[model samples]
Target: MAKDLTVKDVLYALEYMRDALVRTPISDGRARWNMRLTGASVKESVANQVRASGSVSGIEDTGTQIIVWRVAA
Candidate 1:
């Protein structure tokens, strides 16, 4: 049976994805990956702890389904 996702779970997932993005070094490969992962606005925005959560949430609404990409941090 399929399992249901909770809002808290989604929030946690977003946090992980955001952290991964933050940890990524600024390089050509990272740039390409960033483009694929995040949007124009996110790339433009500063990658700080405070801003990362907002940025990740903007990309996807974790209210419905949990973003699987973001595993447990």
Candidate 2:
């Protein structure tokens, strides 16, 4: 990863991975992502992406992992 990568950059990465994320199974209306110390900026980018997706009803970020709730099937 390049130094000085901003949330916008991370968000772009997430956008590129949208197909993969969509393929990830969602059980019980939620999808969990284990971020594993990737840092706050990446987590924030994920939250912002989820919000922009307009599919998930809620988002829970623990600064390490993310649990996206109520994802549209």
Number of the predicted model whose lDDT against the real structure is largest: 2
lDDT of 1 by residue, 1-73 (tens): 5343333433443555442222333445342112224422232223333234543422333222122232332
lDDT of 2 by residue, 1-73 (tens): 6464454444444444332122122457554442223432333345456556654344334432333333322
Collision pairs in model 1: none
TM-score for each candidate, following the candidate numbering: 0.26, 0.28
Cα deviation of 63 in candidate 2 (Å)? 8.7
Best by TM-score: 2
Q: What TM-score does candidate 1 get on C-alpha atoms? A: 0.26
Clashing pairs in 2: none
Model 1 lDDT-worst window of ten: 61-70
- The list of candidate 1 runs beyond 4 A from truth reads 19-56, 59-73
Error at 41, model 1, angstroms? 25
Local lDDT at 3 for model 1: 42
